[model samples]
Target: MTKPFDVKIGINPISWSNDDLPSLGGKTPLSVALAEGKAIGYQGFELGNKFPREPEALRAVLAGHGLELVSGWYSGRLARRSVEEEIEAVDTHLTLLAFNGAKVMVYGEVADSIQGTQEPLYKRPRFFHPEQWRDYADKLNAFAQHTLSRGVRVAYHHHMGAYVETPADVDRLMSLTSESVGLLFDSGHMTFAGGDAVAVLARHVGRVCHMHCKDVRPRVIRHARNRNWSFLESVINGAFTVPGDGSIDFRALIRLLYDNDYSGWLVVEAEQDPVVAPSYRYAEKGYRYLRDLVERVPLEAAREAA
Candidate 1:
């Protein structure tokens, strides 16, 4: 048997957040995920951005569920904000995350838009730009500095829309960043965005701070490419799933992580499926599948090595 990395399964709120949308209550789905996470034997969770912003209240909810806060999503246009302003926001969120023993901050870059037309659409990821890379790097450096100053770590999430998604993009990010600013790799999104996790992790092993253990459906990938599906839309359309249940080769992926000495958490990020699949049933099935995959991954490595 192969040794294991210190990993924890988590759910992204986007899936469960929409559960009690308008007519229904909103908190039900999220509560379900937290409860199910603990009941099914997960050690920690990445609380979604849409959770109640009040840190104390959020802490209470987490305590009730028996889940440790592993990490969380935050938004801002680092290009426009001053470092101090960003630090303030980081401090606030970090306090909540820290209170629950979270060590990593999942940074989501959102373009702040006013009701006015001058501000750009915040939800979409902007196209890649070299200058933007430096600005992003600078922003991350500043945030990482501030986070560390507060005694926490920050992982820059190169998510689908917010400017860092490709292999080259991840390259630029790691090259520009200090080790304090680490990679939060999402296997499903990497492959979905034309990135090979196997290759990318090989290049930046030392800088990977955290991970998301989700996987993608190849048929959905085919549909996504053929139909020009947006990343979020595809996620909403049942394109992502549990690790072994999807097309990703978790054995190779985990082997790479093991070789890299990845001692951080393996967050389970399935944004859209939680709603379509429902939190209780979806999380229960996902937990068992991922746990099994985690257990089997190392044996594959030992077999190959032998």
Candidate 2:
């Protein structure tokens, strides 16, 4: 039987968090993601991990717009001192997101100690010191058990500067972890870290409960290479852009997910300045391209049956 292709749409609030671009959006970050999602044809949004901690209020706001929380990218780190502590933190944060309709909390940060003082964290990353992977997985398992107990799913986001920053690390961590844990595949970040986004997406498709629709510029990547720059630097230097405006092929990527029986949110996460282009221009473009990608990207499997 073919899988359903009811692709979910979302926006990242980081762009809207900018003090500039007061035009095409709202005052707060959650407001911006919800409003933009509504205006640009998105079905819902993954309330960014940094949203206000109050679940009741956030849910109220999302419900008012006829919107749903596709998922929440929980940006909590799991590599703290103890597994017990990590599980405790997840227990608290997971409940907050669940009350607001979110099913996942992305393991979203590097070992905080290693981050140093880079504003925006645009460095090459020295996360090779993941001395806690096995123990971390045990902690994550405990968290997942608690979250799933609360009727929520926990997805781990392997980032560039974070512990699991590369293909080998992602493989080591995911391979070791039990099926209780899910993964949030970020295309742009994977590519930035010299990892194959498509390969990782395909390999971990089953474990993916949610995905980020961010892409990167090959030109900027090459520039970074020439400068011997860091992954975070590439992100800061516009090495990343909206999907269609970048090098990654979403058509093929979406088709893969559609084939894998994947049915979850596809968040349009643009972590860049909206001022460089026309106000909301890149976002508007990304919105259109992703919507079209969802509706128009030939799901041969879906199409043949349709």
Identify the candidate with maximal lDDT: 1
Q: Which RMSD values do the candidates have, in order?
A: 4.0, 3.7
Per-residue lDDT over 171-233 for candidate 2, one digit per residue giving the tens place of the 0 to 100 score = 887887878888888888788768888888888888988788888888887787677665445
lDDT string for model 1 (1-306, tens) is: 566656666655544564313222255566666666787777777776456667788778878877677788767567668787888766677887776677888876666322112222234455456787787787779778888776678777776655676688788888888888878888887887788878887888788888887788788777866776555556656777766667788777777877666887877666554446666666667678777766776677678778
* C-alpha lDDT (0 to 100) for residue 46 of candidate 2: 62
* Backbone N/Cα/C clashes per model: 1, 3
Clashing pairs in 2: 74-106, 122-232, 122-233
Give the clash total for candidate 1.
1
Candidate 1 error regions (>4 Å): 1-4, 19-29, 112-129, 273-276, 298-306
Please provide TM-scores, in order, for all candidate models, with all chains considered together: 0.84, 0.84
lDDT of 1 at 234: 65
For residue 156, give model 1's deviation from the true position in Å. 1.1
**What is the RMSD of candidate 2?**
3.7
